[model samples]
Target: MFPTFPHRKWYEQRIDTMEELEQHVLNAHFPEDAYFRGMPSADFICISSFYRQYLQDNKDSLNWSEQQVGIGVTMSLPEVGKQQYKESSFEILDYFYKCLRELGSKELSFNSIAYLAQHYGLPTNLIDFSADPKISLFFACFDEKEWFTDKDCTLYVSDILWHVKAMMPSNQTIPMGYFKHPTENRGMTEAEADEMMFNMFTTIDKDSSETVTPKIELDEVKYSARIHNQKGVFVYHCDDVPFDRIMHTSNCNDGFNKVFVINKELKPKILEKLNNEYKINEKFVYPDVEEDPNLDLILAAAEKTKQKFDLP
Candidate 1:
């Protein structure tokens, strides 16, 4: 789940002093846009003051290292882009619309504009709040898919931050690494590992209608799979085509692919036993189609290979 802003004044009051407040802010490494969007100048100053006071009062509960507070007050502001409108309400609404337009052009999927509004510190539930009604209407206009994802249903808020950062003239967007530590030992595998891994990757979600469903189907499956031998599992079911390919296609950047760490060691003969005894083939059902034994066999082989090695 995504982290949320503190709601209680006591929680807010616990942080005190410039040094303490600065340390908290640095540790957050919060995006510039999120920081400014969540707190305007007056609010930012107030929060910082309160945070310092809180920290001083509750020193027993908190401890900081020199490395943790290395930087201070170098925080950047969220990109509001050009402030075309003078009215605060209208400016906020227009900013949101601009974000939607930009993200839409990039073919990004979202779940809820509400999350974006909140991230920007706009009044999310404004009917009872003092914000303009138009702000709420703006959020209502976009579909949930425009701002949310299955992971957190939070309006793809992180993507919005990324988009804003990418738009900056000097901002260099670095994609965070998506792999586990390379040196971690997963275990050994036999000669037929690749084929087995592939089969396992294909079979794990064989019944997944979203993966194998035809494009014309109302709920089509648009995914691919990869076996992470080190991780010992099949990483499947990605939303984006490129991401799916990144996992399945050979020779892509190693960082973007999903990894499955195998947790157990097995002999080659175990593959045959799993195939016959588990009837693993029966589980490899294609979306919107009858079962195919050949595909099942292939998938079973991959799964078996994925399980070839166990990590301690």
Candidate 2:
């Protein structure tokens, strides 16, 4: 099974200025040399967004989200029973793969499949994150005033080096058996991996197979340039415990879980600093736009793409 989580919430730091945040990020423990001594690639920051920290995505935690998706019956509704939710989650995944196969996606991994679904606005267990620190900052300041009742936003910066080392104590490269990595280490074909995942994903207890984390092989066919532009990575949920839970398995103190508090009053200034000084924005983060930086806004305001976007 996968390693357990380190649920020990450490003392969080609140920085008043972007300068302080930059100094914290700029001074992080990144190995200076790489090519000379065969040093591992330097650790980079990864970020997860929340309108409010209390409303986190706890284990496909869409069930725990307080936000509304604007659909009639609250598409945000959770399942009635835990068992029913698990069963339905697996079934929905199977349905998604079937649709992908029908649409000519051959031998796709779970991460790739889920990323595609997320981009198209489907309700899956997947949550999105970015590797770019500035991009993370962009998300931190993005419209919390409107969507979250004028609430302050949060940005969680995890050091990837600490995270991977914690997850794979022996080998930092060990894959979490999503769809790409199976437990048996048998050289199974993609279809075989699919079947194996179906069994593992549907399991109810602490079975060994339940820990698999099927991700893209070599991550080359990782399915999205929009994702690539952000230097994105993901963690998919399986029957076994997730990587977050395992971080607290011991008194293991790692640097990957740093939390930052961004005040709502500073948002306007922060946005200006990021957009004008750092040159980061919706276009930089989402890179799929033709030319307009405000294409998302344009589309939403237009009659043609507005309804399709489910805009009110």
Candidate 3:
């Protein structure tokens, strides 16, 4: 499936910048360490991009390898012999995807693929979603120690309306499946939702800040609960659960559930207090806050919490 395009000429013409370098890293299909074996960054981006387009366009027909069910995506371009590297990289990605399909529905995890790429001395080009071109996809690979088959992974898209309504200060919108309710059909007022989300954030921020080292895991529950209560629905691994019902789940006491109630019920009042207490837009950035260092801290906290919950 390799194209005979003059990829080398393209590489020589374009000068890579820090921004491009970061994008290349973020859009990578595998781990950062995987392609570190003297592979030109530009070449990697080109190859990864080629494979990504291929798989996305042919998702239905693609299959995993005999034991691999996950596919990695990324891009790279380097000076000198760009065409050869581009061709070889495309072949590698194409083969990788074919291998996953042949594996027959095995489990896979993002981290697993990342580890695999790292193991092979290939740059995985894993993207930091917290950064610019936030939605860019990237390269990856498989590692026995960290690899999880495709069957093990669950995909969830976040609700857009939920975020708009929540008026989350960070304005961190989840991708399509993150919500339990139908964001498209849910008729919620954006103003009210934002107020509710603000309250939830303030509460969680207050709680976390009070601790010497904030436990983001505990705050996420609070955050999730706030969204659930305000939206009247909470999403769990793509399942839409009513806010009240989610409260009854076995793990509801995990602190997240409890905070959910607070967020919905008291968010408005909380927001009012915070509005009076702090300057607007001072606490957190929105819209284009992904590059904000403060927002990065919040994200770091969230990641730490994820680790605490042992969530994949």
Task: List lDDT for all candidates, in order.
Answer: 0.23, 0.43, 0.26
User: Each prediction's TM-score against the native?
Assistant: 0.16, 0.55, 0.17
Clashes of each: 39, 21, 79
Better of 1 and 2 by TM-score: 2
Q: How much lDDT does candidate 2 score? A: 0.43
Please, what are the lDDT tens digits per residue for candidate 1 over residues 78-97?
Answer: 21211221133233334453
lDDT of 3 by residue, 1-312 (tens): 322212222112221332443334324343221211111122222222323433444456544332211123111211123344234333433333234335432333323322222222232222111111111111111112433222111111112123222334334355233222334435544444456554443231112211011112332323222211211111111111111221222232222211100112222333343345442222221212333323333334334433443323
lDDT top scorer? 2
Q: Pick the candidate with the highest TM-score.
A: 2
Q: Model 3 scores what on Cα lDDT?
A: 0.26
Summing lDDT over every window of 10 consecutive residues in candidate 1, give the lowest-scoring window: 224-233
lDDT of 2 at 129: 48
Candidate 1 TM-score over all chains jointly: 0.16
